[model samples]
Target: MGQVGTKDRFELVGTPPDHQEAEFADAVREGLSASPRHVPARFLYDARGSELFEQICTLPEYYPTRAEREILEDRADEIAAAIDREPTLVEFGSGSAEKTRHVIEALIARHGHLRYAPIDISRAALEASADGLLADHPELEMVGVWGEYARGLLTLERVTDSPLLVLWLGSSIGNLTHTEALAFLRDVRERLAPQDRLLIGVDLVKDPAVLEAAYDDAQGVTAAFTLNLIARIARELGGDLRPEDFCYRSRWNPDEERIESHLEVVRAHTAHIPGAKLEVAFEVGDRIHTEYAHKYTPKSFAALAADAGFAVERNWTDGEARFRSCLLAPR
Candidate 1:
């Protein structure tokens, strides 16, 4: 029901928080110096790199996309009605904003007005999504909060009205360490007006095979996606990383209940990070751990939100029940 009209020029308005770039650089430096297999999950999304990831979602083994899409296709209206009224749609780490359209469309069907805001570290992504969404739904006024999710929360004061619905979709929240996730949601709860709500997508715990396949698809797209982080560093600060020197590995960490991605060194070598003036050594087969995707259960996710001052109000699942979309309200 979102108004479709002539496309308007979309503006990309923001960049990473100044300190973020510095911190990211430092993390990379420290990570490189510490071990052969250390890489940050965040560096995986440069312009071209991000496009590769969208391709990753369509690979047959990637279940989150298909699972979440099924839930939206079947239950978007039910999901929309769970929220009480018209609200600004604010999405954290909004990415290309594809999944968001489902709920946004449903919201507009029930309520004639909407303001769409997406927060992402990549200005290119935000602008691209805003332009597409604006063109498709002229009734939805799009805004981009161009910063890391936590810092972007600082800009929430710019939105007004009650029952604001903030979205944290695509199982991206799984990237955070448990402690970090709790602290972040707590900060978000503190910033909310009383009637505000949060809708988050979670990848559910499943068979080890299914979990492993999602990250380490047979097509190797996910592997290529992981290695691109190295290419990103090479281009960013003039670092020279031989992409072939590192290989991607994804494995289930049963003890931690997560899937971990690592970059393993194929040979002993040294790489130069020009900006940091650092020569980092790598041992053959040593792994620089990059990311962990923690799968969640209904109880665990609800508990995590509750600990952060939220009450789970509704839950939506796909036909396969492989993923979950949770709607929570401020306590």
Candidate 2:
């Protein structure tokens, strides 16, 4: 087996607890039991949770997946041609990596041999995706990193001599604050060689109604998905949480150019957390802010890439222009 790099040890950064599972459960109880209800979506992806998300993407209500696929299908050849050399493909938050298969296949067809490094939060998901990729493309070498997205990116090393084409797909970039996004991109830039390229997907600014529907899907799947975080905490940490007490709500914060997910407390309450050894109280109508999905315009997006030391090479958009995939080159 090849040696793993010093910085590539993902366990140290995204420490998911086996021993502290009970404590985490208590944290969940305290969080939900608080006046304003909130739980982070990052915790929603356990083995089963990740499988649920993959199903969510396939649902008709999800536009990001379909739109991204259309753009990739329409432009994979163009994207393939743009790369001057066959490079290792590095993906951040590589979930099922369904769309990535197209790009990876395209690169291998043109380049003959390519290395793949898929960084993800779930070790199970990483191994599953890597195993599938290896079975399909025996020529492609894969190095899987199980780590938090932002932390892992900061710690990634250039292990392969092949030039890199890094991917931050699924508009997962939107999950961060604007400042965090900028700094994260800048970190990516600092890690690359001058000629390396990046292909980023950004959900464009759109109707508030559309944005709201996507997050708060009519089928109630999104709501269930949000509530699962609380359940996960309860199960893992030994906290008593009534999932019905909190409602999943999403609203467009236009001024901030983001969609905010909040878990709202329906009534005043108090709860005891056995694991954390704390008592928490909640006031009626208090809400815990969960996540923010920021939309971006092409101009602002280009400026962000530029600041990150990348020049926008080409832009591809869905027919309705609801989303865009921009190819960028390191400056």
Candidate 3:
């Protein structure tokens, strides 16, 4: 654990991810040993994967990023106005903080002064974005947390006196399973006061074709993003994975009600990682489950939030209703 320091307008707290490589090795061993090979999506966001995702966001079929921005562009001020008390903006998975500028501007405009606390896994990305943001917004001060979301959030009360506006945007919650999401939100609820608010982005249920295309694009960028996970295993962890043997796949699992991302074995292959002590075998039909993006209707999301002890204060959507930005107050 590292102590929070305040020497600059935008300061980074928490320790660097010295344990990530060890965790990745452990995860690879665990995931590959399972019956259906699986890998956690978080591991896919290494430096290269993060860059590819930024490109994925710009794709025509990928609507979450564009949809979220539309809502913020139209209603950010209204969202900001709901919090009468001056509040600090805190974001989880606050990558480049590209789409976040909308809400940041609104908060600064309404409050005259604003503080942003961005929590992320990458210290370099956080610092780079922090510098860029500070340069753009002179009134904005920042406190960055370069580790997990929970650690970043717990430090807020000690760092700033203002009420906290926690932003879990970009449909991040949708990445978790129902049980996981509930438990995660409950943990977050435990850390917040009744007056503190959380704003979340929820992707709405849409046409199956639309969902599938968003993940498996015509240009094959999404495919590269999926392959990068296996590529990462080989590149970083001394795994002998023939990335060419695995092909990217996306499907709408109607029974499960989610879009599934996978790497299907195009040809039978085996991978061995000395670092993780794993030797995984694959057949032509074998699949490596990489990610799941669940879509929610408003009713479904609100019910889940209520169970986690939050009340929906506001819900904003794009023109096509492709996504939702929900404001939640502690119940």
Candidate 4:
């Protein structure tokens, strides 16, 4: 594999070819200028934001992570068995890859050796996790990609020769709107070979109160995470933002079957982002849309997979049925 940053055992592969700064600036400007001012959830993950999100995963109300992990632990053997012999595992948005160890161990037991490709936008997260994963799985070969999902998949086309099993776990796909999710899944299907497979995790529709509580946790960690976007703008884009002037709130939008998180301006304020060359004015009660987590039913998600040219081969769910992990193959 092509290596970028090689440590004792871990190897970083694939260069980041995108101009992230320019892209971020453009996205920020566009979102701010839109009729209903908003920000993309992807921008919420700088180093500190990523750390906060990791903490959020462990919060009592955040059941997605725990539910997904339970399914992986219970059905990892079945998941590994569905893949081809000596398959290469590629994971998208693999933050720390904590839940992936179950699958890795199961694959290793069946094949004796394995190849893993973990892609993430955060170089720090990739580098930090690579060493520990390498130490734990001595019979594994790892390649780390520091980029977003689509770019990393393009790079994987060149690096992996074995049958591919692409993973998009933790219900992170819920962040995308239905249309965007279909488009993205189609892109992924196009990138995969005929024999390639995909294992995706998705959160299921549940009680509105439960959904809302997950995003607005008791410890205020979720609030801190939502407000970190303002801090990031101030630090990276030279924006004048007072984070304390805003409050984070989350509500269940039953009409859309999604949870929406917003940063509500507590008072009138103007924030200027020098990097984007834009200024945004907010009045009291004004809210900027920050994130959306869409919940799906099993039939709805299966239809989505079919639309993307994949046939759902097998699906495993947690005991509570609050989450599901579906294995799919090209139709």
Arrange candidates by TM-score, descending: 4, 3, 1, 2
Separately for all candidates shown, the number of backbone clashes (residues 3 or more apart, or on different chains) is 4, 2, 0, 0
Off by over 4 Å in 3: 1-7, 155-157
Instruction: Please write out the lDDT profile of model 2 over residues 240-285, one tens digit for every residue.
Output: 6566777888899989899999777786777555665656676667
Cα RMSD to the true fold for all candidates: 2.8, 4.6, 3.0, 2.5
**lDDT (10s digit) by residue, model 4, range 1-331:** 2233335456676654357777778888998889788999988987888899999999999999999999999899999999768799889999989999999999999999988899988788887778777776778778888878888877765554679888999898899999999999999998888888999999999988888889899999999998998888887789788799899988898898899888999989888999999999889999889998999999999999999999999999999989999898988
What is candidate 4's TM-score against the reference? 0.95
- lDDT of each residue in 116-227, candidate 3, tens digit only: 8898877767887877778777788888887777677676664555677899999999789999999999999988787789999999998999999999999999999889
Best by lDDT: 4
Comparison by lDDT, 1 against 2, better one: 1
> TM-score for every candidate vs. truth?
0.93, 0.87, 0.95, 0.95
Task: State residue 161's C-alpha deviation in candidate 2, in Å.
Answer: 2.3
Compose the digit string of candidate 1's lDDT tens values, residues 115-135: 877888777788778767777
> Global lDDT of each model?
0.81, 0.76, 0.87, 0.87
Candidate no. 3 TM-score: 0.95
Badly placed stretches (over 4 Å) of model 2 are: 1-40, 274-277
Error of 1 at 299 (Å): 1.9
